[model samples]
Target: MSIHSYQTALVTGASSGIGAACVRMLSRHDMRVTAMDRDSDRLAELASETGCEAIVMDIRQTEELYETFADRDIDVLVNNAGLAHGLAEGFLGTGNDQVDEMIGVNVTAAIHVLRAVLPSMITRKRGHIIAMGSIASLYPLGLPVYGASKGAIRSLSRHLRMELSGTKIRHTEICPGRTETGFFDTAFGDPQQRASFVSEIRLLDPADIADAIEYALRTPLHVNVSSIEITPVDQVPGGQILG
Candidate 1:
């Protein structure tokens, strides 16, 4: 029995990394895809390569989100666009703009997109929401604001599942750890730091997270994979010790 039931999927941050991988994977499954990203050039390139509908717009612009998805009927929504501006000194160390940007893109924008897309799904009673979370959400790593944003996603996914319990709608949180997506390049200010971190450990690829998402989505309608926390085999958290 085949469980590939979705017809259309919308993936945010689809220009690169996990989002791009999801676009490609979903397309390979014969699902129509709408790829959204702020990077117009990369979005166009991805669309050309994968035959997806590309939308060039920043997710932080909430007003535009409603207008962009006004009439689209999306079966799967992958909230993958997020940013972590340097983890130098946690939340208090960063400027207000950086904090706002992280919260806006990582948390608020997802809610806006959900508001815009959920009505049709609720009306039809069939949809799946995939939230891109991080291991930081579960295991704190000095980046307070980034962790908080992902924790918000983790909480949102849990509550959303409860809110839509009787309906056919499903929610999943994909929490990935230390992915080799060049995300650390933006998260760390020093090039040497990024290089050193990359060399120090084996990181999970974006495709790994995308594969997990694909599996969750392709499950039978009766089965709901609520959450998946994936990390490289080489990486594991140690127990906290009392000093």
Candidate 2:
């Protein structure tokens, strides 16, 4: 679909997967896109391929993040930078470092990005904010820390909907289940383990998740598509829990 509303966009964790797909989609529709990620090589490759402005930096660097976007009036903010670690180990069994990394990148840095862009959006009185979330956040699952991080996203989206009431700004959270991305690689940290985990189901593609984001952005200016949870038909996320 062609985009008529948004002019400039910033997508975080944009070197690959859902983030990269989003950059491609937005750039395809002629939106000026800024793709940010710590992977300089991949980020440059994507920029070369898509002609998107690439900012190579770790999302955890709060000072640099704020400075880089100070002059940008981003129409669409994709707060998609996130990761999961020690998922197979679960929370209690996971390393403290893994816990910190997940929270730092997913929740803390996301807020910083939002703070940096929102002041301008508030002044302009228009913008669309999209937070990358997961189905794990909405239900009981094996992931404790990772799920908690995304759950915070779920709450943030709700609050944005409440706080941005008449500012003409929009908040939408895209929650996808089992997408084929480097996310699994980072989450499992082992190729064989990651493969086995995903082998049973037909995983959703990064572009499929991007399609959901596009749909939300394509809606009428007055219509705010609050949240979308897209999953592969083969993937179901529930089981009985009785004490």
Model 1: per-residue Cα lDDT over 74-127, one tens digit each: 999998999888675456778798888989999999889999999889988999
Q: Ten residues in a row with the worst lDDT in model 2?
A: 234-243
TM-score list, all predictions: 0.95, 0.96
Identify the leading candidate in terms of TM-score: 2
lDDT of 2: 0.90
Model 1 residue pairs with clashes: none
lDDT of each: 0.86, 0.90
| Top of the candidates by lDDT | 2
- The C-alpha stretches of model 1 lying farther than 4 A from their native spots are 1-3, 240-243
Can you give the lDDT of residue 204 in candidate 2?
A: 91
Candidate 2: count the clashes. 0
